[model samples]
Target chain A: MRLRCLALILFSLSSSLARTQPDIANPHSEDTNWLNQYAHGLGEQHTELGLEALQLGDYAKAERSLLDAIQVIKVNQGLYATDQLRPLQYLIEAQLTLGEWHAAETQIEYFQWINVRNYRNSIFTYLNGTEALSGLLLASSANVNNPYSVRHLVAAKNLNWQAVNAIEQTFGSNSLELAPWLYRIVLNHYYQSTMLRRQGLSNYSFKSDSSEIVSGWTMRHNETLEMSYRIGKELLGRIQELFAYHVADHEQISNDATALMTIYQGDWELLFGNDEEALEHYRSAYQDLLQMGRSEAQVDRFFDRPVSLPAPRLQMQWPDQLAAESNEPLQFFAWSPMYPSASRPAEPRGDALAADDQQTALARFDLTPAAEDEPADTILADTNLSLDNLQILGTTPDNELTREQARVYISLLQFRPRLVSGMPVKLENIELEYLFPPQMSLLPLLDP
Target chain B: MIRSVGAYLKIRGTEMFKAIFALLSILLLHACVGSPAQSNAPRLPTDAEVEQYNASVPADEHIVCRDEIPVGTNIPRRKCRYVRDIQQTSTFHREQLRRALQ
Candidate 1:
C-alpha cells in the first residue's frame, strides 16, 4: 500500500513537470526572442541619431535610419503583436521633411491600417482628425480637389464630433477635457469655413438671421489668431514635458518649438489680417532660412510668393479695349443714305466760295445742332480728302454741307450698298424697303 | 528485490510513454489553433520554395533596368530583341536606332 501511494505521488509530480515544460518545437519562442532583440535595437536612441542626422542636413542618412527603424518596428510587431507606433510617427515626420509626399501618404495609410488591424479603435479618432487637418492644408496649398482631401475633411469633422461625444459622455460639460475638445471644435469650424470660402459659398446661412453664420464665416479668418495662441500654449506644455524628463536637449527642442510657433504665426498673419506681425515672423523665418543657407529664390518659391488676386478693373477693362482694337473697323458708312446726283455737283460749287463769309455764317448757326451734324461731313471729308484739305474745308459751311451729305451717302453705300453694275444709271437713296427683293417682283424670271 | 526492480522498470516505461503522449497532445492542440494565430509566427522560406516563387512570378515585374548606356552602344539594341511585340515596339526600335547612331 505504501509503495503504491509513493508511485502515485511520483507520477503526479512527473506529469506536472511535463506539462510545465512546453514543447521544444514551439514556434512562438524563437519569434518572441527575435522581436525582443529588434525592439531593443530600434529603441536604443534611434530617434536621437535620426534627428542628429537631420540637423546636419544628411537627409539621405536620416531617411535610411528612420526607414530602418520603421521596418524593424514593423517586423517586431508582426512577431510579438506589440505596439511600435512611435517609430512610424518618426518615419512620417522624416518623410514630410524630405518632401516625399507619396511615401508620407503610404506610411500614413500603413499606420491607419495597423491601427484598424490591431483594433486600436480610439487611435483613429485622434489620428483621423490630425491627418484630415494636414490633408486639408496640403490640398489648399496645392489648389487641388482630390479624394484624399474631401475624405480627410469629412473624417476630421466626424472624428471631432466623435471626440466631442466621448468627452461629453465621459466628463460631462464641465470637464477639463473640454479644453482639447475646444481646439478640435475650432478646427472643425475653421475647416468648414474655409471649405465654404473655397466653394464660393462664404455668404451661406448656417442659420437664419443668427450671428453663428457670420461667426462661422469669420472663423477661417480668425483661426490663424486662435491657432497661433493655441500652438504657443501647446509648445510651452511640450517644452515643460521635455524638460521634466530631461530626455532631449532643451535649447534645441525649444528652438524647434519656437520655430514652429513662428511658422504658424507667420502663416496666420500672412493669410488672415495681420500682415505686420506676419512680416516680422517671416523675417525671423527668413533669418533661419539664411542660417540654413537656403537661397532667397527657393524660400520665395516655397512660402513668400504673392498670391494673385482678381484685378477687377483690369479684368473688366482690358478685354473690352482689346476687343475694340482687334475688331474690324466700324462699318458705319454701310448704313448711310446713298448720295443724290444733284448733291454731288453742289459740293464742288460750294468749295469755290471765300473762307471769311463761311466763318461769319457758322458763328450765327446754333452750336449744338451744327456740332451734331459736324461729324457727318467730317467723317466723309476725312475719309476722302487729305487731312490738310479736310482741315481747310472744315471751316467753310457750303463745303462742310456738301462733304457731310457725301459722307452720309458714302457711309450708307459702304454698309450695304446696292450693287448697281446691272443698271448703268446711278441710283440715289438706296434702302432696304422690304424682306423680298424688288427686282424679283418686277421680273419674275429673275427669282431662279 | 526482483519485484521492486520490476516495479521500477514498469514505472520508468510508463513515464517515457507519458512524456511522448504529452508532447503529441501539445502538438495536436497547437495544430487545432486557427491559421491566424500561427500567421503571426515567422516563416523562413526554403531555398527551393523561394526559387519556385521567383520562377512563377513574371521577370519584368521584379526587374527594373536603369543603367544609362553610352551613345553608339550596341547593348541597348541587343536588349531590343527581347522586347514584347506591343505598341511600344516601333517606338523602342526607333529609339534604339537613334541611340546607336548618336
Candidate 2:
C-alpha cells in the first residue's frame, strides 16, 4: 500500500513538472505543411525522405524528416540507444553548416543526455565526448530555443560542462576520454570571458611546445591559469600514454624525485616532489645542526607528507634552457661529501660476493656529488672523524674498522651555494633549495 | 474462462494503442522545433568521390576543410587553441626553475 502511494505521488510530481515547464516555442516554422507531414510517415520512410530532401538541397524539408526520424528512433530504440545517435549526428552537421552554434550545442547536449542515461543503465561505458565538444560554441549568438526537453538546460549555457560531467559520470574521471573535454572546457571559459569581448579579442595564437602547428585562442577572461592547466593536461596525457607502454622508460626519464624533464599526468607536483621535498636540503641542514649542536626540541619543527614543490610556476613556465648551451661558467657554493684519495680510500668491507642488481639500483639515486678536477688541492679533513671516536669503535684484528660500527658512507652530500657571490664560489652553508644531486665523484676525500 | 481471456486481450490492445499514440505525439512535437537547416547536404559520399577529391590535393600535409568533408562523416573543427605549448616553452620552464633555485 505504501509503495503504491509513493509511485502515485512520483507520477503526479513528474506530470506537474511537465505541465509547469514551458514548451519552448518551436524555432522552425510550424505553419509549413511539409513538417506536418512528418506525423504521418514511418521512421524509415521519413529517413528516406530526409536523405532525398537533403540531396535535393531542400534543407527545410530535410530537417523536418530528419527531426521526426530522430524523435521516432528515440521513442523506439530508447533515448540514448547507439542507433538513436545517427540522425542527431546528421542534424548537428546541418546546424554547423548553417552557423547555428546554439542549436548545434543543444543537439550535442541531447546526445550527451541520452548517452549519459544509457551509460548509467549498464550500457556501453566509455562514450567518447571529445569529438562532440570540438566544434561546439562557434555561433556568435547565444540566443536559441531548447528543442529537446533537457532538464535545467538553457541553450549553450554550460553545454561543455554538461558534456564533460556526463562523460565523467559514465567513465571514471581519470579516463583519457577526459583529455579533450578538459581542453574544450578551458577553451569555452576563454570564449565566455567578458574581458576578451571588451578588448575585441581576435586571433591570439601560439604553438604548443609539443605540437608543430599553431592554434588561435581568444581570452574570455584575463588569466594564464586556464592555459597552464591545458598544458598540464597535455603533460598528463603524455605521461599516461608513456607509462602504459613503458614504465621502465618513464622511471628512467623521470629520474626519481626531481625530474628536470617531467611528464606528470596529475599536475606539476609530480615533476618535483611536494614543496617540502624542494626544501629538503634546508631540513637536512637543520637536522645535521641538531646532531652537531642544536637542541632536540627543534627537531619536530619541520616534517610533512602532503607537500607541494615550490617551483610549480617554474615548471609551468620553464627557464631559458639555451643557457646550458652557452659557454658561461656559472658559480656554485658546494659543501658535500668528498671521495677519499686512493691510499686514504675508506675500507671496502661489504661482502663482495653479495653484489646484486638491487645494490646497483640503490647506488643510482645516492646523493653523492662527483669530485671535481681540483680535488687534489681541496684535500680536507673529515669533520666528523675523531681519534677518540675511532677508538670507541676499535678496529678488527687486521687494524680495519668493521662495516657494522664504522660505515664508509660513499658520499652523503648536500650542495649549497653562497647566494651573495655571483659565480666561481663553492658551497658554504646549507639552505632550503633543490639541486640535481650529483653522482658519486671519481676522486675520494683525503685526511689532512 | 472465455470472459477472462477476452479481458486480458483487451488490456494488451489498449497498451499497444497508448504506446503508438505517445510515440506519434512526441514525433509531432519534436518535428516542429528544429532550429537550423543546411541548404545543400550531399548524399553519403562514395569511395570514388572521396578518392577523386584526394588525388587533386597539392601539399604533402594539408588541413582538410568542412566543405571538402562528407556530411555523413565527422571531422571536428580544425581550429584548436590549447595554449601553453610545452614543447616550445618547456625549455624556458626548465631554465627558469634552475635559475630561481640557483
Candidate 3:
C-alpha cells in the first residue's frame, strides 16, 4: 500500500507540472505570432456570431459572444486597443436592448476610455470614435425605458461640443470641417429645447449628479429656452460663415452651400417661432439660389415639399440631391419622444420592424402658408396645419388609443411651408404616412 | 544775491540734493506699486486649445469652454474651466448653503 501511494503521488506531481507548462516561463516554449493570429481569428469569429445573434434578436447570446470577443481582443492587443471598440459597441447595443442599463453604462464607460486613449494617438481615429459614440449615446437617449435619458442626451451634446473643439483646434476655427460638428450642436440644442418643453417647470432648480443627488442652481425654463435659441442661432451662423469661406476659397463654387445654409437658418428660426425672420431668411435664400444660376423651376421644385424643421441631415448643396418627384406617400418616422427632429439611427436598435407589426397612419392636411400679417412670434402655435382628415390606414393590434396617439404626434410636428417664387404657398391634400416607433407599438403613447 | 562763491555753491548743492531726493522718491514709489503683479501662470488657452487639452484628458478632467459675459460688461468673453473644478465649486457652495441652513 505504501509503494502504491508513492507511485500515485509521483503521477499527481507530473500531471501538475504538465498543467503549469504555460506559466513555467520558458522563453522559447511559446509562439507569440501564432497566439496573436489565433486570438484575432477567435475575436473576429465571436464578433460575427454576436452580430448575427443581435440581428436575430438573441440579445443574451449576442452579449455573451461580444464579451468573449472583447476578452480575446484585449488579451492579444492589450487593453485600450482600438480593435475592441467594435465588439464593445455591439455588447453595449445588446445590453441596452436587454434593458441591462447598468451593464450598458459600464461598457459605454470602457468604450469612452479606449476612445480617449486613441484620441491622444490619432485625431482621425478619435473623430471616428466620437461619431460612433455619439450615435450610441443618441440611441440610448432615445430609448423610452432609459430613466437617465436626459443625462444621456446632455452627455451626447457635450461630446459633440468636445469634438467641435478638437476639430476647430486641429483644422483652424474657420475650417469647413467645423460645419458638421456645429450643425450637430445646433441639432442638439433643438432636442434640448424640446426636452425642456416636455419636462415643464418643477425640475428646473436642480442639476443631475453622476453618483449622488446634488442640488444645484439651473436656468429656468424660459431662460434655458432662450439660451438654446441663442446658441443654436450662433452655431448656425458659424456654419454659414464656414461655408461662405469655403465658397470663397474654392473660387465661388456656385454658392450652393451658402444658400442651403441660409435655408437651414430659416428652418432654425421657424423652429423657435420667429416667423418673420424665418420668412425673410427663406426668401433671401431662394433669391440667392436663383442668383447662383439655378433655374426658378428647379429652385421652386426643391422647396416644393413641406420639410420638417431641423432637417434630419444637413444639406450643403442643392439640385445634386434633389429627390425624383414620386407619387408615393411622404413617410415620416418618429425618432424619439425626446428628440422629434433627430433622424433615425442608420442601424436601428432592437428587433427589426416587421411588416406584420407595422403601425402606420395616413393623414391629409392642408399645409397653410404663414399669413403675411400674422404676428412675428406666435411661438409653437400650429396655425399652419389645417387638418382635413386623419385616418388610421393600418395598425397592428389595432386600437382607438393607437390611432389617437398617432394623431396627436402627427399634429405636434412643425413643417416648413412649401415656397414657390420666393413666396410661401399653401399645399393641399398632402398625404403623409406616419410610422410609430417600434417600442411604442402596444403601449399607450404619452405626449412627447 | 552776489555774496561769496562758497555760499552760492552750498545753495546750489542743497537744491540739487532736494531734486535728487524727489526723483528717488518717485522711483521708489513706482517700484513699490509694481506693475500690477505680473503673473507667473501661463497665458490662458484659446477655446480651441482648451478643447484639444480636453480631448486628451479623461472626461472628469475635461474643460467646459464658453463665452461668458462679465458683470457690468456688454461684451461676452470666452471662458474655460475644468469640469472637475466647476463640480467642486458647486459642491462647495451647496455645502455652505446646507451649513448655513443648519
Candidate 4:
C-alpha cells in the first residue's frame, strides 16, 4: 500500500512536469514559442538592418525594414508606447529619405500627439514644427506646376507665418536670442511674400512714399500739416532716449535722423506742390551722404537727375542732456537756407528777375525759387497741363523744382487750372548744392 | 493478502497516470490552436482575372466584378447568392472542425 501511494504521487508529478514543458517536436506547439521569439527577434534584427540600410543609402530597403520593426512592436504591444518610439523615429527618417513626404507628415502628426500626451517636451515640439515646415515648403514648391492651386500657396504661407509667430513668442524678438533661427524664418517669409505677390494674391496697400516724408518735416510746416509733425517730434524724442540708452551708436542715429528729415521734406513738398522744395530736401540728403564719404552720384540717379543739387544744412538740435558738457555757444539758425529770390516780393507787373541771375543765385547757394505770374492762355493751352494730358518733363540736374514739375503740373490742373489756363509763366531756374558740417561723419565717436 | 494488496495499488496508480496524461494532452492541444475563424476575408480580384471577367460581361450591365456592380445594374440574385454561400461554407467548416477537435 505504501509503495502504491508513492508511485501514484510520482506519476502525477511526472505528468505535471511534462505538461508544463511544452512539446518542442510539434511544429504547431513550437510555432507559438517561435512566433514570440521571432517577433521580438525580428524587431531587433530589422532595427539593425534598417540602420545599416540607411547608412548604405538604400532608403527604400531602410523604409521597409523600419516599417516592419514598427509593425512588429505595434502587434506585440497594444499601444506604441515610449519604448516603441525608437522604431517609429527610424520609420520617419526612412520615409523622409524615400521622399514620401505625405506619409512622413502623417507619422509626424502621430508622433506629435504622443509627445503631447507624454508632456510638452521642447525637443518633440521643435521637431514637430520643423517637420511641418518642411512638408509645407515641399507642398508649396510642388504646387508651382499647378499655378492656379491657391490652396497650397495659402497653406504654405500660413504655416510659415505660424512658425515665425511661434518662435517670436517663445524667444523674444531680440536677434541675439534667436539669431540662429531667425535668418531661415525671415528668408522663408520674404520668399513666400514675393511668391504671393507674383501670384496676384498679395494684400498690398499702396502707401504713398510721401507719408514718411511728410512726417519728418513737421518743423517747417505752419498749420496745414497733419498729425505727422507731432509723430515726428515724438520719434525724435524717442531717438534721443535711445541714444542715451546706448542701444544705437551715435553716428547711426544721426544718419537715420537725417534720412527721416529728408523724407519729411520730400513729403512736405509732395503735399504742398513744391517740387523745388522736395528737390532741396533730396539734395540735402545727398550732401549728408557725401559728408560720410559715401557716393553722391547715387543720389542723382535716385532722383533721376544728371547732376544732384547740394543738400541744405539740417537744423538738428542737441539733446538737453548734452548741453552741460558743451562749451560752444548754441546756434538756432533755421534749417532752411534764406534764398535771395525768395526775399523779393512777387510783382505781377515788374519784369521778372533776370533768368541768368536767378540761375546763378540758385547755382551758388541753396536757395528757394521765387514765385511768378501765370503765362498767357495760349501757352497754358499749348502746354500739356490738362488733367487728361499730363506729361513728365525730363528731369534736370541740381534742380529740385524741375524734378517736381510733373507733380506741380498735376496740382495746377486740379487746384489752380485758371492760373495755368492762359498763363505764360517762366519758372525760375535755380541750381542748389548741399553743405554738411565737418563734425558730421559716418564713423561714430569713441567714448572717452 | 499480498496479491490483493498489489492489485489494488496497480489499479490505482494506472488510473491516476491516465488521468494526468489526458489532462496534459488537452492543455497542449489547446495552446497549439491559433486565432479564431476569419471567415470575412476579402475576395480581391487579380488584374488579369479582373480583365477577363470584365471582357466576358455585357456592356449594358457594366459589371466590373461580381463583387462590384454599378448601382443601376440589375444583377442576378445568383451572383450575390454565391458570395453568401462562400462565406457560410467557410464559417461552417471552421466551426465544425473546431467542434470536432474539442
Candidate 5:
C-alpha cells in the first residue's frame, strides 16, 4: 500500500512537473518572482518526504514537510489551486496533532475558502462554512462534469468531517456522541446522492481524487441507498451496545433510535421494492409512537402535522436532579412511516374502523363545511386524519373534491409535480408537533 | 452313506460357524458405514411441489405429511417427499398437520 501511494504521488508529480518542468529549469527570464523560480520540484520533494515521515511516525517532520509542500504548491500553482489542498490537509493534521492551533487555523481558513471559492451566491449555498477540513471535504465536491458550477459537496462534507473531528478530538472517537455523528455523516452523503439524483445528474464524487473511496461516487440511486443503508445498519447496531439496556426509561431516545433504524430499514426496503419490509418498518414505527404513549388517533395526528424538524434528536429522560443537563427536550418522529403509510387498526376490530375511514374519505374533499370553521382546504387539518384517510392531493380523484380545494391541490402539485403525474408521492421529514393540534395537550397519552 | 456324511458334518461344524460369523460382520459393516441414503440424500419439496401436493390431495382426506407424499402410490411417481412450506415455516404448518392427525 505504501509503495502504491508512493507510485501515485510520483505519477502525480511527474504529470504536474511535465506541465511546469520547463518553467522550473529556465525560470522564464521575464518572471520577476525569485520564490516561484526556486520553488521548482519543492512541492514534490516535500510531499515525498512528508509521506515517508508520516509512515515513520515522525509527525513533526511530516508536518514540516507537508507545510513546505503546501506552500510550494501554492506558489507554483495558484493559492486556491486544487493541488495545494492535499498538502494543506496533511499540514493541518500535523499542526493539529502538534497542538499548533495558530498554524492549523490559517491552513483551515484557506482550505475552507478554496473549497467554496469564496462564492457568496445562491448556487454556492452548499459551499458555506470555514473549516480547513471543508477544503478536504470539497475536494470531492467538484461537479467534475461541470468545472464552473458550484455543486459544492466539498464544503458541506468538510463541515461534517470537521464536526466529527471536533467531537472526536474533544470527546474521543469512542464517545457515544461519535455514533450519532457517524450516522449524520451517512445521512449527509445520502442527502447529496438524493440531490444529485433529483437533478438527473448521474456523475458525482463524494471524495477528492486523492482520497477516493472504494465505492466510487457515481450518484447511483440503488448503490447510494444501499451503501448508506449498510453503513447505517452497521453503525446502529454498534450504537445499541452503548444504550440498549438502559434505554427503557428514556422512552423518547429509545423510540427515536428505534424509529431511525426502522426508517432506514424501511426506506431501503421501499427503494428496492420490498413492500413487506417497508410495511414492517411502518408497523414498527407505529408501535414506537404508541410506546411513546401516543394513541392511534394521536399517532395519526402526529404524522398529519405539517411542521418540519430541522434535525433529528430525542430528549433523554434524566432524573429530576440531573434534569438541568437536558434543557431542550426533543421528541423525534420517524418520517418514512407517515407517507406511503400502512395503518394497522388502532383497535383490532375491523369493519367499523374501515367504515369510519370511508366516511372520512367521503367528507375529505367535500367543500361543504361540517361547521362554520371547516374549509375544503382544511380537510386534512383534523386530528382524526388516520393513516387510511391520508389523502394527499392527486392520490385520489377529484370527483369528490370541490373546486374550493384547488388551493391546497395546486400547492402540492408545485411541491412535487409527480403528485399529478399519478406517480407515488413520497412525504418526508414530517414533524411530530404538527400531527396533534396543541389543543390535544389536555388529553392523556393513551396506551394499548 | 449317512454315517460318512455325519462324520464329515462333525469335522466341518467349526468351519461352518466361523464362516457364518464372518458373513454377519460384513453385513453389519455395510449397513453402518456405507448406506446408500448418505449419498442419495432425500431432497426437499419446493413451494410449487407443496402446492401441487395440496391440490392433488382430496380436501376431505387431509394431505399426507411431507415425508409420505408419493410414497404409497404403486406407480412410484417422483414427487418432493420433503414438504417445503407454502405460506410460512414448515414447522408451523406441521403443527396444523399434528392437530389434524390428533
Candidate 6:
C-alpha cells in the first residue's frame, strides 16, 4: 500500500512538471524550433497582408509590412533564404510605387545575391529566380524616374546571358530550352539599337561603375546598327535550328513550329529596317503554311491584324489556335523610351508599369497602309503608318496635356502591316489606348 | 673493312633520334607561330559568345567588335578591341591635341 502511494505521488509530480516546464518533461520540445515555426508563420501572415495592402493602393503600409516579413523570414530561415524572394519582390513593387528608386535598386541587388545562392541547388529554382529578377529589372529600367535606367537594362540583358550559359551547361549547346532566352537577348539588341540613335547616349555605359562607353568609339553609328542586325539575325537562326532539331527527333512534331519561327525571323528583320529581307521571309512563311495544307482563309485570318514588330511572345504555331478577335481597344503600353516594342511579362507582381497608377489616353486613328502605292518597293517599310485621321478620345484624368501627349504618342507608333493574301493592306478605324509611364516629364520622347 | 654490328646499330639509333628531334622542333615552331585569332577565336563571335566572354571580364575590359574599312580598302574588316585600350588611346590623342593648341 505504501509503494502504490509513492508511485502515485511521483506521477503527480511529473504531470505538474510537464505543465510548468514542458522541456523537462519532453526533451525534444526546444524553444528554438517552436520560435522558428512561429516566426515563419508570422512572416507569411505579414506577406499576405502586405500584398493585400498593395492591391488596395496603400503602398507605404505595404512596404512596411513586406519589410517586416522579410526581416522575420531572414531571421528564422537564415539570411539568403530563397523563401524570402517573393516578399522581397513585393517590397520592391511597393517601393517603386512610392517613388523610392534608390531603395528599390538596393533591394534588387539583394534579391540577385540571394537568388545566386540557390542557383546550384536546382535548375527550376534558378530559372524561377532569373525570370522574376529579369522582369523586375526590365520594369525598373522602363520607369522614367529611374536615374540608372540604362544600367538596369544592361543588367537585365546580362542576366539573360547568365541564364543562357546555365541552360547550355545543364542541357546542351542546341537544347530547345534556349529559344526564349536567346529571343530575349535579341529583343535587348533591338532596345540597345534605339538608344544608339540618341546623340548624347554615345557615352552611355552599360556597367554601373564605369563611365566609359560600352562599345567605346570602335563602333560607328552605322556599324553599330549593323552589329544589332547581325546578332539578332544569328540568334533567330539559332532558334530555328533548335526547333528543327526537335522536329527531326520526333515524327509527330509538326513543321508549323519552323514556319512560325520563320515569321519571327521576318519580324526581326523588320525591326532592323531590312524591309526587303523581312518581306521575303514573310512570303516564304506564307508559302510554307500553304504547302502544309492550311486553308488560305485560315492563314489570312492569322495575319489579319497588325501587331507591333518583334512580337512579345515567340509563338510556334502557324495558325494560333487559341487566338480570338476582340472588340476591345488595342492597348499599346510602351515599356520604355528605348524599348518601344518590349512588353511587360504576363505576371503582374513584378510589373512597375502596373504599379505606377499612371494615366491612360484613348485615341482613334486609321491604320492605312502607306505602301498602297508602289506596294512592291515599300513592302514592310519602317514608315508604314502615315499618321492620318488621328483623334484623341479621352484621357483618364481628362486633361488637355495628356490628350496632346496621347496624340503625339499615337502618331509616333509603327505597326507591322496587316497582310491579306500575302500582301500588306490597309485597316480602318483602329482604336488604341496608351498608358503614359509615370515621371514621363523627366525624359524626352525620342524623335520620329 | 665493315664495322661491328653493335657500332652500326648505335649510329642508326643516333640518326633516328636526330630525325625525330628535328621533326618535333618543326612542329613546335609551327604551333608557336600560329595566330590565336585564326586558331582559337571565331571570326566574328556570336552574340552569346561575346556576352559570355564579356561577363567573365570587367567593365573597362569589355571587348567590342565592329566592321571597319581600312584606309586604302573598300572592303570591311572585323576589328575588336578592349574598351580600356580604346579609352587610353583616346585620352592620349586628346592630350596631344590640347598640348598642340597650347
Model 4 in CAPRI terms: which quality? incorrect
Residue A111 error for model 4, in Å? Answer: 3.4
Better of 1 and 4 by lDDT: 4
Q: Which candidate, 2 or 3, would have the higher TM-score against the true structure?
A: 3
Q: Highest DockQ among the candidates is held by which one?
A: 6
Tell me the deviation in Å of residue A255 in model 2.
Answer: 14
Worst 10 residues of 5 chain B by lDDT: B59-68
User: Over the stretch A75-94, how does candidate 6's per-residue lDDT look in tens digits?
Assistant: 88888788899999889878
lDDT of 5: 0.43
Rank by TM-score, descending? Answer: 6, 3, 5, 2, 4, 1
- Segments of candidate 5 deviating more than 4 angstroms: A1-151, A158-174, A195-225, A232-275, A291-297, A306-448, B1-102
TM-score, cand. 3 vs. native: 0.75
lDDT tens per residue, model 2, A252-290: 222121222221232232222222232333334344435
Model 1 residue A448 distance off true place after TM-score fit, in angstroms: 65
Report the candidate with higher DockQ, 1 versus 6. 6
- Give candidate 4 misplaced runs (Cα > 4 Å): A1-48, A51-59, A72-105, A115-119, A123-177, A193-448, B1-102
Q: State the lDDT of candidate 5 residue by residue for A195-255, as single tens digits.
A: 4444444433322221333231133555444444554445544454444433564333454
Residue A113, model 2: lDDT of 68
CAPRI quality level assigned to candidate 6 from its DockQ score: incorrect
Q: Extract clashing residue pairs from model 3.
A: none
Every model's TM-score: 0.26, 0.28, 0.75, 0.27, 0.31, 0.75
Name the DockQ score for candidate 2: 0.01
Q: Which ten residues in a row have the lowest lDDT in candidate 4 chain A?
A: A334-343
